[model samples]
Target: MDFELPEEYAAITDTVRRIVEAEIKPVIGAYETSGEFPYPVIRKMGDAGLFGATFPESLGGTDAGFFAITAISEEFSRLTPEFGYAMNQQAMTCPFTIFNWGSDAQIERFVPDLIAGRAIGMFALTEPGGGSDAAGAMKTTARRHGDIYRLNGSKQWITFANACDTGLLFAKTDPAAGHAGITAFVVEPKRGRGYRAHPIAMSGLSNCLRSCAVFLEDFEVPVENRLGAEGEGFKIAMNALEYGRLTVAARLTGLAQACLEHSVTYSKERLIRGKPLGEYQMIQQLIADMAVNIPAARALTWRAAWTMETGRPSSRAAAQAKYFAGNAARHAAQAMADIYAGYALADEYPVKKIAAYVNMLTVGEGTPNVQRILLAEDALGIKDTDRHPVRNRARGHLSR
Candidate 1:
């Protein structure tokens, strides 16, 4: 398999890098301190035609496909991993879910705003009962009431809940049906309706995005708003994660690259024991290990993306990439910190922030334990009925 990215894909990401350096990074520190999501910075991202790089031109995107999304994600994340979260939410999750499974009207109503960046989008599958047991533990309910479904229960740790223009939500439509009864819906929060969102003051990632606690008090969703058929929310949510894990893997690839860059630059400049730190064997080992880990994780992530691009089954691939890359990025963060020594604690340097970024990535897509369990399931030859929707999506890409 050819791992080299096409030239155009490289150009798109390089453009993203330039915009991030010139417009976004200058104020990242300020956002970190204030716990604010900069609307203007995101608007700039929209104006630059980034919000929909993966979407088709008919939907106001570059039609760059999954690779473009991965490219954009990696470059932004190299600076700070938070923007990657926003990208995944906007371009990868909600949009991917809608474009693939939503009704024609649903796509027309929701996707254009998201693609334009005039409206931020969010995906909520995690409930108060969220985590490894997300599907079985989900308690949110959507009761059919003739023309509309009434949504009750709450979702926590949802990115951009308070700030999003549209929300792709999952709820149990039939408790007796278990996972089968769950259904997906698209709601317009920016237009104002049944749901309420409150900001969550998180320990990390406060600067790049905000997590929100969303409460649905009889939020009315029209039957037309239903995503996919009734009882398919579980499948939709699971499929969304396949793509999400790919982005997380790529983002971690960028974080590992950041770790590599920081260490290399610091080693050349810092003097220790009457010599440059780069000359030390121990420092050299750290750099070598980081360099190794980065390309290793990046290769896995790119392979996962390519697998998706090729329209092949990729659940196991996504899980493996996310699991390995997350650990690699975390270890790289530590190595970078060790190299920085006392300076690691200082905000003036990026290593401390790198530490915080990896903490979030390690758990964002799904924890390492979850990925391991999935890989074991695949190895044990368990029939993965849950993988069909995602697999079908990947396969359908070839037809497109």
Candidate 2:
């Protein structure tokens, strides 16, 4: 229950703050408008080893803890949500997942390349057919054919798809095994045999190349690329998400903090009814509530990170942290809009951009509502600890 970040972690946060202020704040709007992936920015992060902060030094990292990683996320996100997310995906999410699940050969081949920012990696689980019900709605299949597995399916909303050279792809390997049939693979599009990745057009989170829908049609993959074991894809994917959810929670906290700060600052300077808006009772109330929420969100996120670092299973805590922080960010954005009135709607005003960033973060990674279900399941001690498994499908078949 300690709320204090360690001195070393605090130092890390300070370092991250300087990096974000210098590199991201100046051109955030332009990046958002262009909707281009920030490759140069990513290269800077890679050079700083920001992408591999928590990874083992043996694999080219500083070997910081998960909490330290979240601490950095919070600081960076406050400046620019896209910048924070892109860096995390590069530094922590994609690399950590691969390092944790990828084979030694896969690790040797991919981790260094990814960390160097020479290549990029993405994790895809969302699909067009099923957004929340990822497992049952996953229509992608990877069938075994001797030494090679031929994959045929499509994944939508795949983050970093445009720039990522490699992906941790989830597909059904044993249609007969249902969720158990799901398998994780270290899939590269160029080595793709028959895969096609097309850019998906989306607005709002324009800094991100809207999650691309990757199509695999008889894409041949070596058996060695199979992550973990057959029937283990679902588990590996869930574990990766458990870690990723915390990172998202941290980012949401940062975005919410930014919204609150913006609103507070504007309220202090803008006069209304012959006095500063901060002098108005209603405006003060909004600002006060916002102030209260940011720390609560940070505390929850850090708790979850601490739990994970301590080797405890923390799905409930993770879900609660993500759900609360995401909602907080969205509410803070709206509050900022209310405080600024017409100005909040203007693209030039930061709150307008803040609203878009918060909205996307709320739904991405995992939606807030799904997190609620996860929290309930964990609290009630549901039959399955794993909440993401396809509920309607039988164990043996992919079909519902």
Return the top candidate by TM-score.
1
RMSD per model, one decimal? 2.6, 5.2
Give the clash count for model 2. 2
Instruction: Count clashes in each candidate, considering only residues at least 3 apart in sequence or on different chains.
Output: 0, 2
lDDT of 2: 0.77
Clashing pairs for model 2 are 51-91, 176-396
Q: What ranges in model 2 sit over 4 Å off?
A: 1-4, 25-36, 207-209, 383-400
What residue runs in model 1 are displaced by over 4 Å at the alpha carbon?
Answer: 1-4, 26-36, 384-400
Backbone clash pairs for candidate 1 read none
Report the number of the highest-lDDT candidate: 1
Per residue, candidate 2 scores C-alpha lDDT tens digits across 136-239 of: 88888988989888988888878787677877889998877778989998877776567766777655556544568787789888898888788788887777
Return the TM-score for each candidate structure: 0.93, 0.90
lDDT score, residue 91, model 2?
A: 62
